[model samples]
Target chain A: MDIFNGIASGFEVVFQPNNLLYCLIGVVIGMLIGVLPGLGTVATISVLLPITFGLPPETAIIMIAGIFYGAQYGGTITSVLLRLPGEASAVVTTFDGYQMARRGRAGAALGIAAIGSFIGGTLAIVGLSLLAPVVAAFALDFGPPEYAVLALAGILLVSSFGSGSAWKCIVSATIGLLMASVGRDLFTGVDRFTLDSPQLADGIDFAALVMGLFGLGEVLYDLERRIKGNSAPTPKVKNAWITGTDWVQSRMAIARGTLIGFILGVLPGGGATLSSMVSYAAEKRAAKDPSRFGKGAIEGVAGPESANNAAATSSFIPLLTLGIPANATMAIIYGALLLQGIAPGPQLISEHPDVFWGVIDSMWIGNILLLIMSIPLVRLFIKILQVRASIMAPITVMIILIGAYSVRNSIFDLWIVIAFGLLGFLMKKFGFEPGPLVLAFVLGNLLETSFRQSLQLLDGSLFGFFARPISGTLLVLMIAVPFLVMAVRLFLRKRVAQTDLQKEYENA
Target chain B: MGVPTRRSQDTATQSEEVGVVEADVDDEAVTPAGAWSHLVAGGVPLAFGVVMMLGSINLGLGSPTSPQPGLWPFALSVLLIALSIGLLVGRGRFGPCESFGSGTLTVIAGVGSIAAFTILLPLIGFEIPAIVLAAFWLKILGQESWRVVAMVPILCTAAFHLLFVEGLGVAIPHLFSF
Candidate 1:
């Protein structure tokens, strides 16, 4: 009865006339961001963050969360239709999705992806509902050092998730960590790298950095390929509906992917990428013909798509229950919470059960709403994509400028966005991935505070980082994992080279 | 185990070629226009972080009880520098201009317009400056139609003003007409 009471209360809060409108607006913007090739959910959330400065904390957060998940639904559309992933998690889906499109199964592929996402999302909501309170209770005991270690561990783990060349990942992560240091020293008050520019006194805005890196950077990269006159051939989309056989084949993959994704998502620092990769591998291993995986197998598309959505849903457990964000995107959401004055630790559930439960409850409503909106609009979105970037570019630039200016009504911030946009374009050209940079920027403030607090608590002895069990264990793992990955990569490389040599010898 | 193997196999044929092509692409992406000036494009955050770091010197940015003021900015600056270095080096290693023509113009145009808009925004208020900025940017970027140029700035300015100011109660600073 009380649970029912709680649900009713949640509905009352979320379905408020204004809140409902905000939720609808949030999803629409989220879908637009996800459908666009360069923009992602993080950028959209950050850009809109300042606008939420006046709303109720709960309403603002619910709407933002709605945007985050809504984008997940829209991300698949681009990956399937254009072979261009709007979000990182959708990268894997593109493999099978584009293939299926090529084979005239775009409808079936789109159908399964949508249905699977809904199922996974609904399941994750149920899981979160059951687990949040218990997890929150446990997280109450954590302190500053624990938080510091958690953030550090997240950065390390995320770096490892980068594709290709562990060294590149390491270097990229290190650069991110270093870029995090660009502003005033939180400990000493000494400017380390500002070089006398008055504009940098506040340090880098995570919003501007992400907007530049992802949005501007991608534009530059795309321009390069486009100017070469290699226009993307618009594939003729076939019946975008799911058939009975398609459903029968995809049911198992979706189920398995959802389960796998939710579990992996519970871990820190790995969400869409980890879940999709794991699901892809699982689907391939279980497939009758594994080769079909890269060639448009329904299982391939369904499993990874389901896994990505499920993982995106489950990533909330750590945030809601433990007050921890395992990656950059979640870190931004955490920032949103902080702005709302809603501290997300162990006490959140009992202290603010309505907020927690309402948000959780809203996820279901939001997903269902997204399903209703997205299915009918899939074709419309596909048509929207056909609007040449050249045409859309101007509109986007206007939106970015207006969005930037509206935040704090500050011209300074708009200028900042513009400057960062250029930086982003350049960075993309240079092969530096912006993901780690944005992640670093988000973690920058926390890492500094946490490190300094730990130092202060331990009287400046570095040993304190290792003295705490949780911190110590995590640090050791962070140190060990990199070396292990490096060694393994080297060993494999050596082995491969030896095999090639042996083959040459045999030919001789 | 298989992931790495499969990845390597996928890239095996093209890894070396990819490296070479990537270097050429990098150069194309950043040529006479794309060079270190591109680094200045990042000057906002770099400068912002520096100013914040400097302010912490005396402001007691972080308290001794929790965290000192200088702690966050210092860390942020270091991260910014490392990232910048990585970007610079990564670009340098790759080179430019084998494929795309003077792509750095996009970077320059984007950064220039944004900076110019910021300077003009406070002077003219939201609508005129925003419209001019948007129209100028659109025209420069190749959208020539008056409708394409005119509609975006006017509509966006109104939409933003309504959403942020009227609807949301966000304070919007208008230079001239309310």
Candidate 2:
């Protein structure tokens, strides 16, 4: 009854004119960011963070969340038509989607993907509605020790499950922690790394840091491999629709994908990209004829598409309930929420129920919007791919500088953006992911706070962390899961198209 | 823990972009020079960690129970030093390390002009710097034609002035109020 009441209230919030309009704008922008290769959701959101400062907290979160999920739909457009995946999650779709397109079933491939994404996203939102409160309820009992372990687990999960080097992820995390350690200490009221700069006393601007790293850094990196001036040959994608046979064939795949995506997405570091890969493998294994995959199989497109959307939706569980972001993009959202002065924790459901339920319910609306807009917008999305990076690069850089400056009306913020931009560029060149660094930085203050608190509670023995039931269990599992996963991976040496998946993430 | 090395297969996998922006990440990312990049990457962090660690020590790290201002940072600095050392001793590409290519000059140029824009903005107003930076990028970085380079930057800067200043009232220091 409470859940239904909550849902009804959520609907009322979402159905408001301004809220609906913001949601619409959010998805459209999300679709644009998704269709464009290289300028990822993280970077786009980073640049937009400053702009969101003016909006109401729920609307800001709703719009940002729409961009996050709308991207799932937008990415599939390029994969089916041009054999180029606009986002990492869409990489697996290219394996079969392009083939399907080559066979003149581009419409069908896209049609099924849209339907699958809609079904998967909607189901995951429903699951999130049901499950997030339970998880939040369970986590409400968590103490400082539990929070410390959970934060550690969150960072570790991001580093381990994320693509590229785990060592680098750790290194990236340390740098982020270092960055977070800047500004005056909240506990003792002493400057740590402000270097006597009055601007840094408040800490490096979050908007500036992210814009430099993800936005400017990405642009500078792209200079090495600049976008071609030539426009793409017009893709001939007519209005796509799924046939009854196509639906029958892919229905089970979508169902299975929904389950896989939901489960993986709820776990730390298990995001849309990971779920899509797992779902593809699951579909391949469950297939009556395995050879049908990677050769224009509708199931290939269906399973991964569904799974990724589901995962994207379900990944919200950890962040909303526990205040632990599951991935880089989630970290940015977590920061956005923090900047809005709304701490994301177990108390979020009670303290900010409208924000909590509003975000959850908005996904339902965003998903429906994506389904309705997918076929109509495919041509426009493809046309956007032709916009040369040269034209957009400087404009984007200008936007970043302005966005950073806009944050606090400080010129120093502009310097911060460029400085971090250089660092971001160098980071990418070195294979150190900026994702973990940003995640760590955003969470750094909380981690340090909980850590100090936990230690005091433990009487500084530190081993007392392992004495508590919940924190101790979590710590043990965090330590054990890597080895368990490694053993499983080694036992099952039958590697799926996992390298290709990693390749896409690296691209992203 | 078995640490990761930049394997030869990773080089193969670096071919991420296929159609338009084909990632030109060749052996350049993992060359003999790349090894030095590894040193720079590791050494910079290590040095920062040691300095910060010393600073934290000076800040008076209390015992774990009675923590001081520097305690948390001290822990982080120590962790940083440890990770940096691992990065140094670890063989092969520790992560996605790239050798600065020819385009790095383009970045340098772009950043340099932007820096000029920042420095000159408050002193000489945002308009001139914005126009200059935009023009430099369009003409030099983008290699646009004389006509485009001539027209776009002025138009773009005027557009920015209108949007941020006149339209939005952002309070960016500008030359003319109107």
Candidate 3:
């Protein structure tokens, strides 16, 4: 009943003309960019961030939030129609959706994606509304040790999950931390790694690093493939419309995905990419026709689409309640909040209910708007997908260059983008996963700073990490979960191999 | 098309051709070989991390009231070196086979475009360099007709200038500013 009142208040804020307009605009832009390969939320958000400086912080936050989730919905379009996923989470969608498309069921695939995203996003918001208050209350009792443990657990899980190779993930995360170290030491007048460059004193901007790694690097990878003739025109779409049976098949898939996504989204370091993967695996396991899964099952499209949207929505809880950013995008949102001079903590809800409630209300509104807008535009989006690499390749690269230059009006940033672009290309060539590197880069500074701060609280000892029960439990979970997964995988593989050998021996 | 390898049946045939074109110097380490190249990549970061740890020991570690300078970096670097060693021992058992195809044109165009942009940025300013870079890149990538060349630059520069400069308020260094 109390939560219902909060929801009512949230609706009142979201219903305002300005907030509603911004939400609509955000979703439209999110869809457009998401439809375009090599253009993601990070680039769009970063480019548009400076403009939000003039608007009401609440409105700006609402609009940006709209773009974030809207993009998730939009990303499914290309994945289903063209087998090209605009975002990482949508990668799983391409498996089944593209197969469906080849089977001339593009319409059904698109419909399932849209409907699933709406269901998932809405349910996750409900989870946020109900669960955030409880979680915030629980987090209120946390001290430095608990915070330390949470940060470490976040880094360990994020880096490990981000990088397919555990060692690579660790190294990339470490590199992120080192890059964060390039400023004037807060306590001493001594500079650590500035190398006498005055600009280095302030340290590297996370935006610049993100742009370098994701934005520029991605375009360069595209360029190399195109030039090598490996990126010829992909299969084009004739239609992207859904049929009646799609809704019936997708209802349970959407519901299940939303639930799975909500739980994962609530956990620190659990996000859209991971949720989508798990949802895909779950759907496959539960499907009566498991063999049809990778061959264009409608449930596959519905499940992951729902999961990603739900995960995207739930990621906001930690930021609003505890001032903890579980990922880079949320961290940037935190930065934007800081610029508004709004300190996110226990007092935030009571003190700034409008900002909090307005955002919550707008997320629901944004999801509706995106679903309505994207459904009709599915064919149009597919048409844009037909835009050849020749046209997109140059334009994407130029945008990268200009984005790098515009950040500080410095040419040096352009060089940084170029350097990172080449590095990204080489990494792609060698099968080095770039997602972990980017995620680690984003979380690198926060992890190191918090870890060190916790140590200092305990007079430089690891015991502090284990002193807090929550921290200790989280650490134990972090160490245990990966090993358990590994062991399970090994056991399953061994069993299968043994069975195969036995069959062969008997036949011989 | 040459005869697709047996390995091509399970894997995407596209990347396989690129792989065959490359000299397989360490073929044994290539397939299911592990993370040798990953281990090699870890070396630079590990060394960087070791330096930071040593540097932090020389500096004061900040406490609760006052944050220390080297504290975060030092600890992170130590983590880096540890991870690097872990990667070497755990992942360095194998390497990826390099591609041997002639991607020289792509490499040149891709790398050249950036170099040109950097050199041109301070001289001709953002608009011209961006347009030129866009045109050149598109051309090199095989969209060389005048329509593509003309339309792409005009649209790209106009849209970029509008979104970034006018809309976002990111100041563009004008041609004469340099």
What RMSD does each model have against the real structure? 9.4, 6.3, 7.8
Candidate 2 TM-score over all chains jointly:
0.93
RMSD of 1: 9.4
What would the per-residue lDDT of candidate 3 be over residues A1-508, giving only the tens digit for each residue? 6667877888898898998999998887788778764556765675555456567888989988988888887788767765556777777787889898788787778878888898899988888898877777787877766766665666566655542455565566566657756777554667877777777777765456656666666666555445222232335544455667877777788888998788777555537876776777778778887887778889989998999899999988878887766665675676567657786655567777888878988988898888777777666655454344445566666666676676577877777667776766666555455555555554454565566567668777787677678888878897886675456335534422334322222111
DockQ of each: 0.16, 0.29, 0.26
| lDDT at A338, model 1 | 66
DockQ of structure 2:
0.29
Model 3: fraction of native contacts: 0.43
Regarding lDDT, does 1 or 3 come out ahead? 3
- Candidate with better TM-score, 1 vs 3: 3
Error at A55, model 3, angstroms? 5.0
Top-TM-score candidate index: 2
Window of ten residues with lowest summed lDDT in model 2 chain A: A226-235
Candidate 1 local lDDT, B52-161, one digit each (tens): 55654544445444555454545555555554455445543422312235544654665566677667666666667667766775566543446556555666667666
Docking class of 3: acceptable
> Can you tell me which runs of candidate 1 are displaced by over 4 Å?
A1-9, A163-240, A479-508, B1-101, B143-147, B161-178
On lDDT, the stronger of 2 and 3 is 2
Q: lDDT for every model?
A: 0.64, 0.81, 0.67
